[model samples]
Target: MIVLVVTACPAGLRGDLTKWLLEVTPGVFVGTPSARIRDLLWDRTVALCNDGRALLVYSSNSEQGMEFRTHRHSWVPTDFDGITLMMRKHPPSEAKRRKGWSKARRQRAAYEAR
Candidate 1:
């Protein structure tokens, strides 16, 4: 069995995926297919997805009985002591703003002052 989760992608990609897998919910697909088909599907998704992200999880003989693959996703799959895990990443400090207030805040301040 394989599961695919796609987000912020074109409708065409989702429509193509429906030919093989059942979309149980928006952006979530599941199906029972041979390993070859699963790999081919993943390959096609990788090739077609533009500026979108996908996460693939399939049954395997691993310790958790599942494996993961990601395409263009910020959270990466990692092996921690032989166990698969998803690692969350924080944005760079440079991307964080340390100063300045928005116009909304300025307006609120003036209102409070009045």
Candidate 2:
């Protein structure tokens, strides 16, 4: 069994997926297809995602008995203690380091030099 979910994707992509999977709801598809076809569909989805977010979940032999792939999503799949987990992308720090000394430091340096 496999499930696919897409957000903000092209209208044609939804139509294309309907050929192989059932559209259980808007942006959600469920189906059971051969491994080859599943891969092909995922590839097509990635190609057509176009800045949209997509997630593909399929049955696997892993510990969880399932595996998932994602495209253009902030949350990433991670491996922790032999288990697959979803982790959010960390944002960059906003505070930047200053290159030069402060006014007080400069004034102290000048006094010490004298």
Kindly list the per-residue Cα lDDT of model 2 for residues 1-114, writing each as its tens digit: 999999999999999999999999999999999999999999999999998999998999888999989998888989999899989887777468577899999999999999
Lowest lDDT 10-mer window, candidate 2? 90-99
What is the lDDT, from 0 to 100, of the residue 98 in candidate 2? Answer: 70
Assess the local accuracy of residue 87 in candidate 2 as a C-alpha lDDT between 0 and 100: 94
The best candidate in terms of TM-score: 1
**Residue 71 lDDT, candidate 2, scale 0-100:** 96
Q: What is the lDDT of residue 39 in candidate 1?
A: 95
Per-residue lDDT tens digits of candidate 1, residues 1-114? Answer: 999999988899999999999999999999998999999999999988999999999999988999999998998988899999999877777667757999899999999998
Candidate 1 stretches with Cα past 4 Å from truth are 94-114
After superposition, candidate 2 runs with Cα above 4 Å error: 94-114
